[model samples]
Target: MRVHLFSLSFLAVCSTSVANLLGPVYPAPRDLSSKSSRVAAGWKALTGRLHSETSSGSSLLKNLTFSVGLFSIHDSAAESLQFHYTSSEIQNAPNGTRKVDGDSIYRVASLSKLFTVFAAMRELNSEQWERPLTEVIPAFAEYVKSRANADSVYSTPWDQITPSALAAQISGVARDVLPWDGGDLLLQYAIAILAGLNPVPAAVDPATYGLPPVDLNDALSLSPCLANVSEPCTGPLYAGGAANDAPVYLPWTSPAYSNNGFILLGLALANLTGKSLDEIYKQSIFDPLDMHSSYSAVPGASEFPRSVIAGDFTSGFGYDGGISKSSGGIYSTTNDLAKFGTAILNSTLLPPVTTRRWMKPVSHTADLQYSVGRPWEIYRYKHAESGVVTDLYTKLGDAGNYGSFLVLIPDFDAGFSIIGASALATRSNATSLLADLVTESILPALMEQAASEAKKNFVGKYTSDRLNTSLALDVSPSGNPGLSVTSWVSNGTDLMPLLGILLGNENSRLVPTIVSQGTGQVAFRAYTATQEKSGGLFQRNFDVNDWIVVGSGGYATKSLAEFVFEVDVQGKASRVELPACNVTLHR
Candidate 1:
């Protein structure tokens, strides 16, 4: 079945009314030469500036034994900056001062999703997004068998979901509720109830699913939740007890992780080019870019550091770790990560066209936008002097009690990463501090330098036929110029600094025109139950509505229309109406 996925298009126009209202605005960023020099002087100067305002910030995290590292490499030729950081000291702090350098490996939590993204992209590059799960992952069939057991309540086929959907978290597969909460164990307890091993109250309805009668106090007394909880999937019950119940079953096991998403991409890539993810990364990325420390899997973990990392959830970091690894699992140092970023900016890893496609935002949810190449989060930042809007494209990870974060400003060729222990006390605050430091201080400085260097080459209006958007570009006071795009029909409002890497040419002009020969038609289908209707002329109990267009010009007045459809209980369309339509005529 083919789903009608939405696409956005733009129209070109010079509106006098808009121009008069907004006025002729020049694109200018802040003047950052002095600021950049001050910040680059030393960590003392930068951190001192940060310390003056918020004593409660990283200072509070000082005693927590958290390790914070920052590395920034600026490529003057490419006008980009790359950086990363990691610290095992957060995990084994104080007494066990294992200084985390370039090689220290910590559980990267959801940061592993980066690996998944790369793997998926590799597959896409190799022509493998549409392949079957079983073909890509042999162990996936076993998961299907396990979930399809006679007593199992889940009846959905594993193959019904796609790798991309799983990576994007749109598969509709309900995540397992960890037992830390007061909810009943849905899987194991349900199984026990079905097996008659657990007794139900005589007055209770057998069909009504209720929380397992297992007392939390008793369970806690039996075994603590933190002990031996190697694989998260095994113990669907999040409460205490059975922490060491070897072979726990979290909703997404290792096989399920690979099968559900990550491995599918790996398999797709392998099938497309007859090369494993390891080989592909080595050839296409690592070798070419000299990212020597980067690897698909962590080093010294097993015979094949890569293969060992792909073991069952029991042997790995449980569901969270497994899922992220499949998607974002990549081990690299700050230096190597910087190299990777530079490679991307310089189009060393992939061609410029492919790089732009990778960075193009892919819709995950209404609120969140991601792309094949990067993960992004909407964040609000406050600096001493100014507050600016920053769409921080970053990937975050948390493995067991370890975590890491990597953020990139593609437009500026600037980015930073923070890796540390996953312990609760320091994880959130520390990561936030690191990110703030980068965004408020480090990245701004980097962007200023890049802007200053590339000032001459980056002045012009850039229009997109695909997005039906046009950006008026000019240099900023800081060096990087501001790009302002007036509102189009599709995008509701004017966009400032239309933040995206410029694809195609600076001199290219895009004009939006209507296709006059064709008439556009959109249909709504409804289902109904009525009397036993047989043939093509059968009658239905419910009423059906059909919308038809007799002429082309009648519907061609506007360039964009937002329509709403109403359906009846019988699944038949009651009515279809165009609520609002906006058309912009190109000048």
Candidate 2:
């Protein structure tokens, strides 16, 4: 009913010739082949600064042993320019120490939550996901029935909670069920006690001392898997532990970080699939992605050589997390994690549509930059030049002596992993530092590389063999970004007019899509701008658009705006075929 005048103006402004319209489709991006080299150099400079800073032993990256991996589904060069830092402090014997690389193993802490949620998606149906925790885990259901007061803030509402809630960390449950998740702090306490710095009186029993107990009726914590010190919590153990625990927030009230939630989720998944969480992770993720260096729990002694082990917290590494393996107990190498991240970008495990649904945010957090997805901690990274916000679906983990980060950029079909360990037991600081440094360095490179590739591959004019039908495509870094279809003519009849567009010219963009129509083709759909007429009274976006919805939809069963590119050996565009027009155009 309405159109954006600027759409027509922008399209027409390209030039007097209709061919100008295509210039936006593949505007030549600045040549950044040397940018990656600069990035590599920048890392050296930054790491040199870090090395100088680390002599203090209190630097952010002090005594950090870490690995980083970057991956892109479409381009192999995205992995280049990675850095590894190994601190001599982490090893007792540095005489024969080997450098950490992509293959160095480290505990991945909460990043395991992503794998747990992924396994659930792979095996559970919608109905199963919606099924209440009581139905999913009979043990929890019985606990709910036994305590008529189970729905209060002092206890969890297991009957109303579902697998989805747990996966999203919205189940109103406590953050951790494992006493050992506190091993780092416990180690500190032990050191304090031995140092004669009495934070507590000598009369308090060591077992009864430290953090206050969380039990509801009695002053002591009720369960919290009190029965199992060495094994995964049994059904009754986990249920009783989570049931008596005080609620952090009301169900669906907000998203809180909860390893306990994922542990319960893992248990529910195990009950539903009739398999352990370990099996699910092994079968659904690690095996499919060929993540050979990843392990659900402590790696075998043979694999220990490849593991980055250090600090007093290292003993906790062998502690069996049991069902908690789904929460924060998995171990993986950057090399294998790169495979995992690239698999998600490539849609190698799930269908493209399903993968799309899985990567999205379920709810926003108090912080504008953060959102919660299916166990994903999403960060909104804003580009300085375009102000375009790139959603980074990420997971960060810190436990015992290890810390890690997994980041996926769906918009760019790229991602990276950071794994770090410290004798000082800084769970995530080192990895987080590495992640920030690498993110700053790599995001622009990815953006530039994508633009460069699009420029080389898709920019340029195309015409039918008859030369009567012509299409011009180009890209622009600002104003109109990405690939745009600037001009189009079919047999000397302007297609813009034939489409009934009274606007000056067609303002359309060729937006990239995750799915391809055929083998060896890159998929893209057309997007056009339109705006609904405003009566000059008050206004609402209900009718306004950048020009909303023009050239955006399909005609009949076929789309009126779709295009696929045939690429060359180096992935440069060879031809673009429009299925809607039933015509193929070549460069």
TM-score of 1: 0.49
Query: Considering every candidate listed, which one attains the maximal lDDT?
Result: 2
What TM-score would every model get versus the actual structure? 0.49, 0.79
Per-residue lDDT of candidate 2, residues 6-35 (tens digit): 111111211111111211223222222244
What's the residue-level lDDT of 235 in candidate 2? 62
- Where does model 1 exceed 4 Å of error? 1-45, 49-60, 63-97, 101-105, 123-126, 138-160, 174-260, 263-288, 295-298, 301-329, 364-390, 422-424, 446-587
Q: How many pairs in model 1 have backbone atoms within 3 A of each other, for residues 3 or more apart or on separate chains, i.e. clashes?
A: 42
